[model samples]
Target: MARLAPSFGHLVFILSLLQVSVVCQTPDNVNSLLTNLFANYNNKIRPVNDQSLPIVLDVSMFLFSVNAVDEVNEKLVTTGFLGLTWTDDLLQWDPTLQNEIFIIFLPQKDIWKPDLVLKNGFKKLTEMGGDFYFLSISNFGDVYWYPYEVFETRCSIDITYFPYDKQTCNVTFIVWSYSADEVIITKSSGGIDFYEYEENSVWTIVSTDSDIKKDSYESEITFTITLQRKPRYYVMNMILPVVCLGLLSLLVFIVPADAGEKMSYSVTVFLAFAVFLTIISAELPVNSESTSILSFYLVLQLMIGALVLIISSIQLRLHYRKSSRGMSKFFVAIVRIDQFLRCVKRYRLCCKKDVTTVENFDKNEEEQSTELEAAIEWSDVTNAIDFLCFWFLLLVNVGLTMFLFLYITGS
Candidate 1:
């Protein structure tokens, strides 16, 4: 029994030490501190003791992730938390009094905070922060509040150079109830904190800026985030395919007139361009203020396709004409130009030692000259049209493609 008494005393001593440690670490005076702090507190009133001096609130943001950028609707959705700090004279306490409580957290509803709201919200305005959120109050009257939210704000989309474009979006915030004279909002030392930011797949953050604009009526802070599109997806799927199709349309002149496929092939390609244009239009906003250069380029290609179909029909008509009908002067001139471009040379007979050989050569040369001097046939005219049209359309396609892409990239 005597040995057991000392062991029991040792166990009680250890338990007492643990109790003291916990009491020191946990701030047992929190309940009393809160009760005293809010006993005479009025949350409806600003936490300033002086009625003449305004409360200076510092504002900042910590970005978490970029959810989505809706171009058609011109909206930017982001997940982040707003950092707000201000001096709350009503909530201050002396840490040395009543067990040295330095910091206390109170329900955000129980304390006085700036009535901040998103001024440029895409949807209707609503109060920020949930009922469960809390505000941290320090011994010296500094209050810190972090309200996390998924903010959807209005952002004007300029898709003039879409898929290779950069956009600047602003999320504006203001104190709805308080005027600039009552609550002066200032940007924090760190305008925006990107330490917790996650990269987005479609858009890359190029830069960020914050501006605090003050007027006689109110003060507002705008956070601007510039994003550049990662264009590899559009380039591979939309751009490359459209360019290849445009070049393929020029192949109509390559098909022989008698092949019976020229008309159908040209018509099919023209329809394909129409389908692609429709698809692209559906993706973009139907706004007339600004137009995408890619859309213009597509329209030009479609026109070229239409022209190819018409020329194909004419070529087919000329090709089937009866040989009895002589070719027009215009047709003969086109054939001659085509022949000159192809470096076709006239046949000339050379002198031979044998009289019989000379005579035979002269007859052959005279016959060849007569055939050359004869009127051009309908077949020859159609062939010349095909050759000229192929090269002409090919140059046009190449020029348009190169100019469109180069201008887009440079811009």
Candidate 2:
């Protein structure tokens, strides 16, 4: 009985060692597993026997950040992580041998992968990430792929309501040449996810959504992201200055014509408006479908400024001209209009003492004097004309500015 006990103890010890060795075994190499799964893999053909067994392609995106929205180039640059998954029945492995594995290979690998690509990409697809660019596989023959990419894509921009415009941009994924019978693209479980968001200086992300469209020949997965422009900078730098200049232009009418700087001041303000127009043009897109309301407002102000320049020239000429030889009736009409408006009442008060001391200060001379005061009466006529025009132009400027900017911004 003692000899039998020793032999049994030795046998039990040997079995325990064998179990430990198996438990601590090194996992299988991913390459060896791939070799076993795809011993007869054909990269050129679909990994299915029946064409009716459509290759289901699942796609998802994690938007990490927005790099830039280039208005000049009409492109949207973004950085994000994209994941793809498909199943290949031919690559199944026994879970008892190896549960799951993740491996990465160039697109030119031996195993079959769907030919999915961005439809509106502006650059070629190139690997840009470290360890995260890889493929995952389960024992049930399901294949997963994820890659991080940063690139630009074409986008249509509308600047009609600019600085307050909402833009919708899309990133679409589709099978390059594969048909519906072979490759069927669909959104993954969560579809689209925003992993992180950072506030932008010039634009704000409003919302995001996804949709899938299938046709007889192909399928598509598109992600829509909406963004709005930050208007504070535009209002402060571009809008406010031009509007203030418009108000300053009205002062050209109030400046006394005899000051000798009225024409020069109008010219200076005209040039200032021109400079602001150039600055705004540089910031806005040149080839968009619709022009900005601000551009229209600038042009309107420029036209009014030009008209005021012409009027200032006329008023200055009338102030200094000494020839009243043949226009007696015109001078008489001018005196009547100025008297009716009471535009020169303060000037008369200052000259009252001089009039009382004159040798022949006739009371009727003040009421019926045509030739006696032709030069002075013409000057008053110019002032009366400027006063009326000043109030009219101011109203037009204010009303037009309010209608164009505020109404469009709210809309």
Candidate 3:
């Protein structure tokens, strides 16, 4: 019995030693595990055992914020990180062999990463991610790479509505070197992750869409962000002021032709319209693909200002004409039309009958009527022109202002 007891103790001691040896075989530290894993790894090659099978890459965007939407440059600048995941067959390892470590982060430079590039970059086509970035790798060979970037992409600006415009911009990424047969990109289930997104002051994200476009040669993933401009700033600063100027321009006719300020006032308003147009042009891209309705409205107002200036000059010339010269039939007809319109507007039946009764008068009254009609002077002609122009232009300015506002806002 004593001999059997000694053998049993030795057997227990032997089992314990074996257990210690097994534990020693496992990696003691993360560095040692990485060294072993990468000793035979070749990052220059794709991490696939079967060269014929394509790498199914899942892609998603984690939008941070919209930095700017430059209308003049037709560019969209944004801050975001791309979430890319794929299986690297050569990177797999047994978790039990690495102190039960299921996941570890490695410098992105040391991995066989896909050569993803910005397909629609505003500057130039460049590679995604930086050397300082790290990639998360699991024991099952799954790799997760989050590459934060300040992406400036080409976005076609449609300023047809200007401040009230809604723009749809796309940020496209693709594997640059690999063909569609070798690298197939897919939009992840959680396509665009806006959980960490920050709001932009000038633009509000209305909607987002993501999809993978595969062609015969390569595959690309596109993230579409629809933005609506916050027009309060433009409405208060630009649009409203222009509208007021348009209404103010109509007042050129109201200024007395004898008032020395008539020409100067009309000229100043015309110049102001010119300055506003120049300011607006500087803000928009130099393209004729689509023009803003606001621009069109401004041009029309400028033309009206010019017409007012020309008519005012003519009125001044007539006001100073020799009083000995007889008035033309055209001027007489215009004066009569003006009186008739005013009488109709005031609902005065007596004033209406007085205009018609001149035609049916007796011989003595007819002669007096002729003398009265002959009393029309050049000053009367100028006043008649002013009255007609004022009402006509006021209606035009109001109608144009209402149409411009309604069209742009309702768009």
Candidate 4:
């Protein structure tokens, strides 16, 4: 009886297989199968949220040169989720021929007002960031393909940045390209479709888009970025300030090492460097992980500042070396008194005094150091300015050199 039962089950299975094959081979049967499959598939997928669909929007390359964005509603979405369209503009009135576009999507689920403070909410979309993917020209999926120098992202505790929250999350995606005149966004598809279990609404995505286009034929590279916010912060906070500080070093050459305030400028430069660092830090996200070119600049500037202080110390020591026992105390004491009016008065008859006494005093000091004032080479604090300035200038050039070097080599 047991063996018979097994044989019966096998016969039933074979019959089912035969029935399916026959149905599949027939036109009517095949239609029925397709209808059932589509019905079942759509049933499973239709109720899903936007996140469930990994595809973004399609980008249509239409114009040769453009820098603008047009917000499209859900109605604007094409019926079929398919390939993006590429359009070419033959009118060479402008230089490039591709439209610049940055398409962003906010999940529908992020539709709640955030207290934003202690206002616990779902982590920001980026916090949930996993893999980043894009379609390519060939195998083309590249973030670097864009022409812009910086990617703009805003971080705020405000709920308004989220589209669903009625507050739009600001996403600034910038591009800079000379070869492309205009670009159209036809399709943005492909990514993990995220679904919100609670709201069952659309997932939230915060995005910002922007563009800067420049045309220069003489330069080998027609496209160049003016803002340093991405790397621009480096210029405002580190590179520019460093360059400024370097230039300030010229004060060393212009201002005599004999100037009483020479040492003071070291402190001034140090504070300036410190202030610049603060600005750089302020511009970056306050987090544990160090990022951006500004960080490098911070380190560089701080090093430069430290270097300035060190050189200042060396100046003090150098001045100390040039001074003999009694003379050192006498000069120091004399400097402390009335701007050294006593010393200048005693020596002024040697040269024709003019309204620009300070300027002439420096000339005389240099001449005297070389000729008459052989005993007094230079003061420590006074000479510190030149040394500090010299080193600072060198560091600035090095920084610029490095910036240009890295920019060129992409190091």
For 285-364, candidate 2 gives per-residue lDDT tens digits of 66557787777888899999999999899888777777645545664565455454443656552232111122354646
Q: In angstroms, how far off is 6's CA in candidate 1?
A: 37
Candidates sorted on lDDT, descending = 3, 1, 2, 4
RMSD in Å for candidate 2, one decimal?
9.9
lDDT of 3 by residue, 1-411 (tens): 455446888899998898677755434577777888889999988888998888999898988999998877888999988889999998888878677677889889988999999998976766678888989999999999998899999999998988789999999998999999899998765357775788999899988898888987999998999999998988887778787887888788788878888889988998888888788766544557788887788778888888988998898888888672466678877777777787788986424222334444455965754654666677777877988989999898899889888888998
Alpha carbon deviation, residue 73, candidate 2 (Å): 3.5
In order, candidate lDDTs are 0.82, 0.74, 0.83, 0.35
Worst 10 residues of 1 by lDDT: 348-357
Q: In model 2, what lDDT does residue 329 have?
A: 62
TM-score of each: 0.84, 0.77, 0.84, 0.32
Instruction: Judge candidate 2 at residue 117 and give its lDDT.
Output: 77
lDDT score, candidate 4, position 126: 33
lDDT computed for candidate 2: 0.74
TM-score of 1: 0.84
lDDT of 1: 0.82
lDDT of 1 by residue, 1-411 (tens): 455445888899998898667657344577788788879989898888997788999999889988999876889999999999999988888877857677878888887888899999977777779899998889999999999999999888887887688889999999999899999999865356775789999998888889999998898899999999888988887788788888888899889988999999999998888898788667654446678888888788888999999999999988898872554567766876767665443443332111112334446766643444364567777787888989988998889888878887776
Can you tell me which runs of candidate 3 are displaced by over 4 Å? 1-27, 271-281, 322-325, 350-372
Per-residue accuracy of model 4 over 1-411 as CA lDDT, tens digit each: 455455888999999898666543445543443343234333222222342332122321111211111122111110111123221111011111112112212222221111101011222323211124232221121111211111122323222111112222222211122112222122232221222312112222232222222233110111111111123333444456666775564454444544656568777877776776675554443333223443555576567667766766666666656444344444433333423443465774342212113335556555643332233334533443454456446767576546653553343
Off by more than 4 A, model 1:
1-28, 189-191, 279-281, 324-326, 344-373
Best by lDDT, which number?
3
